[model samples]
Target chain A: MKVKSIQCKKCAAPLSLHGGGHRIRSLTCEYCGAIMKVQEDFALLGQFKDQSHPDCPLSLGTQGTIKDVLFTVIGTVSYRSNYGDSWTDLHLYSETHGYAWLSYQLGHFTFTRRVRYLPSRNMKQLSPREILRVNDQPYQFLEAYQTEVIHVAGELTWIAKVGDTSILRDAISPPFMFSQEETENEQEYHLTEYIDPEAIDANFELEYDTHRSFVHPAQPFKAPIRKALSKASLIPMALSVLFMFFLTLLNMGNTVLSERITHSQMTGGLFVQDFTINNANHLVEIQFDNAYGSRFQVKDITLFDDTHEVFTFGKKLKVKSSTISSQQGTAQFKIKKAGKYTLRLRAITTRKWANSDRITPYISLTIKEGVMNNRYLKYLFYISIISFLLFYISRYFFNKKRWE
Target chain B: MPNASHYINCPQCGNQLPLTFQYAKLTVCTHCDSTLFIEDDGVRLAGKQSVLSTIPSLLELGSPFSYHKTSFVPVGKVRYAHTIGYWEEWWVIGNSGKGFWISVDEGDFAVEKPLDLDSRDVASIPSRDDLYLGQTITLWKDQWQVTEIDKGKCEGFQGELPKILKVDDVVPFVHLSGQTGQLITLEYLDTGIEAFQGEWIDPFEIKREG
Candidate 1:
């Protein structure tokens, strides 16, 4: 590459202005370190004989390529916070694309470019929970403050005077950072992104190790890992929901063996019914449709397989209102003979106000038998729950890696 | 306004004035403090009397500095007294022959240039009472705040100013600050309205004329 012919005003050292320095107003001497103001010629502006810049591998005039575009180093400016934290901004210029910056802090690099547009909302509208979205990506607020220019060097498009301050607000979405810097004359928005140094070095065919391993603030997880995790999380949940729907559709139909449709008024006596089981190892469902919302008194409710005493229980239900409902009892067992079985219930039914002469509450009963796989579906549901938890945990960690 | 001339004498006080430009519409007689109006015939009394007094400042006429890529030399100054104290405004002539201003209140300095009405969005001039500190007004597509409000009178004048200034003239003005320390000063005078846009530049960042 050809270099411009120029001379430092102070030390008379040979210097060259690269990357279209036509608008540049200042350049520092590489020898005596004198700040020179450029116009038709050059004039000495200041001196910095003692201050040292940040130690970094790249220096002024380092040329590098990114995404097939070549960028030349032109200048570097340093800014400081009130707490004394400082960072250097390397201004890079492309002959066809104009200017951009690389923020260097402790070996970390963030590629930045000026933003061309902004959201309509103002700064005050940015809430803690709010993530301002641009290009379908949400940007979370990081910090905001006024930073002072502490140091400056090399050729620049505009005059960068030390001690000048600017208002800045920063936000980030993994791999990307958004900033608004307001100088006295103009407000500019910029976007910064984290790039893998290994990729950059590999693309440029450089021998140096630019691979940084430290966790940067806006560094993103590997694309493949995040994409796979997201897919693993979503696909299983969707399949489980669809399977649940299928199980529900199959479980809706039940075969009724016996049901009493006629109203049977209880006269405070015991009632017994002999029912036969047609199949072995099947669920026997006994149901009672109750009305009048009355207190039910039943004693020694029992089921017997030819007096073998299969199952016995007792219960009492207190009546509340006229809006009555049904009751059910289910038992799944092998009857062995698949023959005669008797269900017996001793009960007294009455209303809360006996003197009111409302007719005694009528009771109804139904018996149903079916082959059910409710237990298996329940086990599958629990397994799906575990998978849901696993997916979410992976997602949480993935998002943390991507954004924090 | 008359064309350029070498020299002329004040009609009221017979003070010889070294007039150089045709656009020097209004000037002061240094010997008698009489305001003179330069016209085609000659320098005549501006029909005004001013008992002016000077204020001490760090920057005087002919002080040169570079700002916004333009080299300028301070050519004029106007002093105004407020309720709290006094502030001075200096008009600097640029290499392009255009004019700029530098305001000094206490120790702060602001580099300024005149703004046309088309550069602002506000339709009408706001009343003095309507302007308060912390109020915001948009100009040149950026928001600026009214940081100061003062009712002052012209206390002193010197050199060739963009506009005429007479002692004891009512100069009600407001100072606005942008988010990044830019300044917008609006001066309301009986003759007309004037607006100047500027930014607060640090003295340490400036390199004096060598």
Candidate 2:
């Protein structure tokens, strides 16, 4: 049946069913604000003084095709859960089909419809562990909650009054679900399935991006976030690989210009050992291995090449960590002329914090002419690992915050 | 099989009475008030009276509704009431001319067809009082629970009904339900036990109307 013209009996205001259905039973008049019951004559069923509802992207009377079915938005109802979160349900009416609903919560959308089938088992006895097969699809029990209608607006086919409570039981297998709204008198069942916001927005030709929050709880974005982060990390990772390759190219040499390893003991308060670099075209390195009997702090070690100061160390450094105190210090001395380079070292023989009986310990000294002690490679190795770790950790938390 | 264009002359009122229900044992004359019942010997009359009610159901008597993607035109209605208010059972003639009932109780609606009584053993079925909530009662190898058992009286009726019903006729019916929204109404009458199987529905979900 099609609606030609209808009048509100309460105020005699001309009204028309928004969806063009003559089967409209109870609807509130937009002009004088009176609920009219459609019959031979419109009877005043109730007075809708405060008709309020939440704002939604899909407005009333907005026609959109969902699942290949065209539906008109006829009503909107707001429901507040016990957890302080609320959602809006948009009732869609199809004159030749039936009623369907779209629920929006924080930009997440779900389309639902009342479903009926021959249920073989007792549904009330089912728990989460049990599975219910409907139309060859398996749905697992999720949870049950009670919700109350806080507000409503527009025309709804069923009675939509405020403070009307219903116990809703939900079962799901991802986007698809089986739901039942149980009241004192009747138990209404519905099959609900979620719709992607992007698809819905595209179909309705509406912009919902601004209305959507940064993250949707039910949206599957964590995996995609992780994948994007991994792709982004290729920049830093590639930098590290390139940096390591450069270090490998720079530190390529096996030139031992001069070498000497000699052990000598000095009973005096200080000792000095000299090693000469006979050949020096490449870099020259003068190394010393001092092993003492006990743990002791050593004063500054300085080396002089031909009485010209070459290398020095600041601060009292630690010897060997074990009882056999082993310490190593190196100094680089490069001479343009290939000649004997005499190097001198300084040491302290005082047994401070030492646990040994020998006050004097033997020290070994070696001088190389071609080896260069460049510690940039070691530092670069440590910094690369730390940087990669920090970058990966930041990406993890960034995605977690956005998705959670 | 019942014919959608089936018509007969009423013996009591001498008016055209359309037999729309397949298992209809009773038919009412639209022109004259004649409650006639079909019998093996011949069509007899329990009494001649017209049925009337004030229940405003969109799927009222002689209205069209759809079920399972099929169109059905209701030709009879049964009015019943318990303590709360009145509910209705509209007997519809399906596209195949089969008899089915669309029961409207407040916002809760269902379309049901009569079940075979002799198909199941009812010796173990508990009475409506003994069955608690969440309990199951087996009928014809299917399990259902008595959700609400109330005694309702037939206030009025119109059109064609499967069984002959009159005003002030008392009936005790137990509303049995299973997990799939599968509902069964076990009505106890003087004619013994009667079973009806159906699934609950939302009235607004019914798409077409005539």
Candidate 3:
């Protein structure tokens, strides 16, 4: 509420020093185009006439709280790059905290503060992709550009001229940027962080263009849920792998019956055997081994518990080659009762015209119980891998957009 | 140590002024704003110090404030005018009965304590002519980078101070920054060079006491 009142040295217009404390050096009259040196009895330094004012939502002496510190907008400097890019920087001041900058460019806002920490190398000497460390954190060099001051108003920490030019270099470690400003007399470093438009609107209560057409280099990626899910997916992925390992270890079951049936043991093209299943509520596997050249077909294999039939399985087997080889086939079923079971198999041999002699073949059969099934865990492991990849892929593209 | 109840009459205004600290060297008369210099022989009138403009500040003269759970009362202040503007340093008495300095420049704040350097250490400090900005200097086994080298003059004073200061007397100083917001300042005084070491303090962390 307390401010210094002075009259313009040229136009005699009333002026008020709202902030910048005792450190400000110059104040420019908005009514007339005269710049006065505040330290030297309001002496006229120079004049900038017919300069157009840039679009700014906040006016001089507008108070706003940023990051828990109340600051007043004391000055506005509009700059234009050689590439035709223009932005406005608002000089902010606090009684207890010092001076800072709120820059608005392309519908984006960023808050910047001068930092004492020095970069590892000079800003002009840095190459693209080269990292510069400030306060022990790495920032990648983004760009370097030349900007000239086009318009200025109100009070500033230093003297302002309309045509003053400076070179600025920027480096980013996203959501944060390190900028180096170099002029003819001085070089300084500033650390800037991106601020959301909603936050700025809430604090300053200004309505301007809030639509951003491109992602800012300092804007943070907004997919927090995806990032969290990416981190959380590792837990399920690890558990599934561990369970698959344990299932593999318990894959082989106890062999309950192993027998060989000769051609002479068969009666009327049928073979019968009695097997005792010791473990119930387990997967029972029935496997058969035969010679490679045999053309015998397994018409039916039946399992009976006492008088009722439990299950039946059948397969036709044809030998494609006879080059001193053998083959095996297996069938699995879950057994619920631990009791004596009878197995019956019916087979028929195909007759060939070239061989008149009866070449009867023998078969080997094995039965086992308590084998583990790991089909569902395999599917879960695949789904977890897919989820992990999806989250990271989205993050990668988001970062790529930011850098681009 | 001087008596806590020690009082002196201003030579210029004839007002009673209290010497609250043991090493008090100068006290400004609240009645007429005359600066009084305390010497071994007697108190002498230095000059009149200009009253600074009222600005909302975190620490005020004679006001107790708590920082990092420790309480301190600012007894005096000296404002120095530089090329850019001005900065003020407050002389405060801590809860432990020790005196320290808190400097406020623009928005930056620092709490400093006087540090004694040996003859060898004093000799190693670069002269004012040889120092440059961004140059590194090793002190107290730590590397410090020179941030600013400026020459300022005493603009005014208020309350009491432990150092003899005159209005418009030129004082050159260099500011250096170390790891973790640490600061080291070297002032080129007429007697010699004086050094103080401390760390930067956040203004928000200071809690004012009524």
> What stretches of model 3 exceed 4 Å from their correct place?
A1-17, A25-59, A80-86, A161-163, A196-198, A206-213, A220-223, A255-368, A375-394, B1-22, B27-54, B60-75, B80-85, B92-102, B108-160, B165-210
* Model 2 C-alpha lDDT per residue in residues B4-74, reported as the tens digit of each score: 55667788767866666656777777777677787766788777665573533557556676756888887
Model 1, residue pairs in steric clash: A290-A325, A294-A319, A295-A319
Least well predicted 10-residue stretch by lDDT in candidate 2 chain A = A257-266
lDDT computed for candidate 1: 0.65
Two-chain DockQ for each candidate model: 0.01, 0.10, 0.44
Docking class of 1: incorrect
* Candidate 2 CA-lDDT value: 0.65
lDDT of each: 0.65, 0.65, 0.83
RMSD of each: 19.0, 12.9, 7.3
Sort by DockQ, best first: 3, 2, 1
Q: How much TM-score does chain B earn in each model?
A: 0.79, 0.86, 0.93
**TM-score of model 1 vs. true structure:** 0.43
Tens digit of lDDT per residue, candidate 1, span B75-104? 667887787456678777666766678877
Task: Put down candidate 1 lDDT per residue, A49-94, tens digits, no spaces.
Answer: 6545665556678888764457777888888876576788887766
lDDT of 3 by residue, A230-267 (tens): 77888888999999999788978999888776656778
In Å, residue A244's CA in model 1 sits off its true spot by 4.6
lDDT of 2 at A243: 67
Model 2 stretches astray by more than 4 angstroms: A1-16, A20-25, A30-33, A37-43, A65-69, A94-98, A106-108, A114-144, A169-180, A188-202, A207-217, A222-226, A231-345, A352-404, B1-140, B144-210
Q: Best candidate per TM-score, number?
A: 3
lDDT of 2 at B74: 78
